[model samples]
Target: MFNNWSELLPTIQKAFGALGKSNPKMVKAYMALGEAAAENEVLDAKTRELISIAVAITTRCDGCIAAHTDAAIKAGASREEVAATLATAISLNAGAAYIYSLRTLEAYDSLKG
Candidate 1:
């Protein structure tokens, strides 16, 4: 794990606070966007956080993974759920690599020919 989430979230928040000091309106807007996106109409908070975790993994965003993992637990995601979400992320990443390798093979064949 790249971050100890318990410690990292506060550090991230402090960094954001510094950014807010520099540009208050933009920071406010960004915070508001987060709130709007997290509204639980179509998806519950737990589901949203789970999806965020998966996206964080795919994007290789350590901060996002730490934050959303915390949020997912707070939103009532079980250990089983977390494991399943990670499994899905792993499968999707591998599948993407597999598909992209086909393109690599095609390029190699063209070059060889």
Candidate 2:
């Protein structure tokens, strides 16, 4: 029934927190990687936040979406940029799902033949 991530907070929160606890060391390492990326002068803070926003949207992560959206704004990303990043995310999600659906249909066709 939930068509968008705005409607999936509870599910996202449970799974996201579980992942952080499931492997603290790994999660720390991943956080370090994110910090490294954020510190990269070539990328700029705004770009880093934008990337985070893109990742959050693609993954349908409510907590991440909220965090990164805030970070993006603080890093000077315009509202338009944030909206565009979400749109891009939606397009990529659709493409990925379509690919899998097509593969399933192809498999079904093979079985029918």
What is each predicted model's overall lDDT from 0 to 1?
0.91, 0.81
**Residue clash pairs of candidate 2:** none
Best by lDDT: 1
Model 2 scores what on Cα lDDT?
0.81
- TM-score for model 2? 0.69
- TM-scores, all models, native as reference: 0.83, 0.69
- lDDT tens digits, residues 3-24, model 2? 3545455566677679989998
Model 1 Cα lDDT, one tens digit per residue, 17-58: 999999999999988987898765688899999999999999
Winning candidate number (TM-score): 1
Please give the distance, in angstroms, between residue 91's alpha carbon in candidate 1 and its true position after superposition: 0.4
- Name the lDDT value of residue 23 in candidate 2: 90
* Poorest 10 consecutive residues by lDDT, candidate 2: 1-10
